[model samples]
Target: MRTVDKTYVIKGKPETQWLLVDATDQNLGRLATKIAAYLLGKHKPTYTPGVPMGDYVVVINASRVRVHESRPETKIYYRHSMYPGGLKAISLRDMLQKHPDRVIRQAVWGMLPKNKLGRRLIKRLKIYAGQEHPHQAQNPQPVA
Candidate 1:
C-alpha cells in the first residue's frame, strides 16, 4: 500500500499594505463597501473566510463624504441605554458634524463579518477628517 499526501499548501507572505482612499465628494455607502472589501481581503485571490488577511486603509476627507437625496434628514442613527426610556436617535447631518469619522467607520464596519476576525480587520482602518494624515511614513498607495 502506498501513502499519498493530501495536505494543502499555503504560499506567499502576507505583507502589511497601506492604502489611501480619498472620500471627497464620494458616496458614503459606495465608499464604505469598497473600504470594507479591502479590510477583509475580499479583493485578493488568497482570501480565507476566517482569516485576517486584510490591508491597512487610510481614508482621508471623511467630512466631505456625501449621501444621496434627503437621507441627511431622514436617516436616523439609533442607540439605546440599559435603562428604560433611554433610546436615543440622531440625524445623519448631526452625526456627520459630531463624529464624521465614525459615520464612515460604522458604515464599513457593518459590512464586515460579525466575529473576532472582523474585529481585528477593523483595527486596520484609519479615517481622517482632513486631507492630511499621519501615515505618510507607511507610503500608502493612492487609490484613484
Candidate 2:
C-alpha cells in the first residue's frame, strides 16, 4: 500500500507574474470572473486556499466594459452614511460614467474572499480607464 501525504507544503520561492487583460468589448461579469480567478490563484497548479500566491492583474480599457440588457439603468448600487438619513443610491450607468474603473474593480472585488488575505490580493489589481498605465516596467503578458 502507498502512503499519501496531506500536509500543506509552503513554497520557498514563489514566482510572481504580471498579467494584462484588455476589457474592450468584454462582458462585465465574464471579465470579472477571470480576474477574480487570477487574483485567487485558481489558475495555478499549486493553489492554496489560505495563501496569497496570486499573480498581479492589470486591466486596461475598463471604460469599455459592456453590460448586458437594461442593467445599466436597472442596477442600483446603494450606500449608507453613518448619519441618520444618509442612504444613497446610484444607478450602474452613473457609476460607469463617473468612475469607469470602479465599476469593474467592484465587480472583481465582490468575487474575492472577504478576509485580510483577500484585501491584500486586491492591492495587486490595477485598473486603468485607458490603454496607458504606469506598470509598463512589469512587462505584463497579454491574456488571449
Candidate 3:
C-alpha cells in the first residue's frame, strides 16, 4: 500500500533548527547513534526519505566521551592515502587524546546513509572538544 502525503512534497526545503547535546562522560557509540538520528531527522514526524530534513546538532564536551575499557587498547582506526603502503592505524586511546571530535564524527558517520545526502547531512553537525561553543547565540535547546 503506497500512500502519498502532500507534506512529503517539499517545494525547496523544510524548516530546520539547531539542537544541543552534551557529551561529557557519555558513552561514545550510544551518544553518536543518538546524534545520527537527529541528523537524519528520525526524531521528527515529518521525516522523508532521500531528503535533507534533518536539523543541526551541536555537540559539546566531545573530549569527555567514553568507551569500554578494552576498546581503548583493542580498537584501532585505519586510513589510507590512496598510495601503496599508505595505510596508517591509530589506537582509540591515541585518537581520543589527539582528535576527540573525530571519534564522535566517525561513529556517527558509520550510522548514516553513506551517500550524497548523507554527506550533506553530516555537514549540519557541529562538534567541539570543549564545553564552550559559539552557537550560544542560537540558544540551542538541550536534547533530553
Local lDDT at 138 for model 3: 85
Order candidates by lDDT, high to low.
Answer: 3, 2, 1
Report, for every candidate in turn, its global Cα lDDT versus the true structure.
0.90, 0.91, 0.92
Query: Tens-digit lDDT track for model 3 on 34-94?
Result: 9999999888888888888889999999999979999999999999999999999999999
Off by over 4 Å in 2: 1-8
Global Cα lDDT for candidate 3: 0.92
Q: What is the C-alpha RMSD of each candidate to the true structure, in Å?
A: 3.3, 1.8, 2.3
| Weakest ten-residue segment in model 3 by summed lDDT | 4-13
Superior by TM-score: candidate 2 or candidate 3: 2
TM-score of 1: 0.88
TM-score of 3: 0.91
**Which residue window of length 10 is worst by lDDT in model 1?**
6-15
The lDDT leader among the candidates is 3
Better of 1 and 3 by TM-score: 3
lDDT of 1: 0.90
